[model samples]
Target: MKERIMSKDLMNKIDALGAQEYMSDAQLAVFEEHLRGEHERLIVRQQEITNTSMKNPESISGDEADKANAIQSSADARAESEKNKAMLRSVSVALQAIKTRDYGYCIKCGEEIGLKRMISQPAACRDIECETLEERKNKQNPAANLKIS
Candidate 1:
């Protein structure tokens, strides 16, 4: 049947993508391992931030300037943690896409994402054109940062 043939073709495509020579499977594996380690590190860092409250305004019991600096530093750390969390979410989505045979395809336009881009960014969900548009939109309106994958 046509459906059966299409399914087999899809399987073949997936197999080809997974092949070691052309797709940078080994590099992706290394990048994934590095990402996992970074995720763990960020979790530990977040925990440390949560545990450290002496710098908070309520607990500072110190000079006003020092308290202000502490608050600013704490805020910066929280922002960094949030960025890390976002990146982790992107990585998680990329991993799931790989498992679902949806990797290497632009989530937005469905074009084949370049292998070089994929190697450079194992979590990429968009080709350059789509990604550029998304970035421009996000820069213009932060709230419009649509989840790609």
Candidate 2:
């Protein structure tokens, strides 16, 4: 699945970015394999949600609170699944950036994103500088200030 997301050309681009004589190909191969496993797991989770949608009946209970809680849980699960789908799409975009030789650099500032940051947030497009500024802007935006909690 990981290979499917990013093609052989993408791998060659990543290699060019590394530009070192040292053998880092094995490490990248391992990481890609891990990502493939994760993709399979996500597929299973999506399938589970689909199955649940078909099998789950409307909950009825003597205690109204219990029924309400069950409904809320289902709603939360659906919301989370939607979020995962968004993240997967972001991952695809990131892979495209990698192919374009623009991965691990801030789109706004052209600074190299630290290895730790990329490992922790592979789909991140901006480095800390740009992201922090963006966060401040969002915080100041009226729409972002809407109370959700």
Q: lDDT winner among the candidates?
A: 1
lDDT per residue, candidate 2, 1-149, as tens digits?
A: 65345444444445555654222444344334534555566677777776665424364554878777667777877887887677666666665665576766788998877655665665678988899998999888969756587
**Tens digits of per-residue lDDT for model 1 on 1-149?**
74355335444444555646433555455545544655676677667766763355557767989878888888887777677678778877877776676777899999988765665565789999999998898899986665666
lDDT measured at residue 22 in model 1 versus the true structure, 0 to 100 = 38
| The best candidate in terms of TM-score | 1
lDDT of all predictions: 0.68, 0.63
| Model 1 error, position 47 (Å) | 3.2
Q: State the TM-score for model 2.
A: 0.63
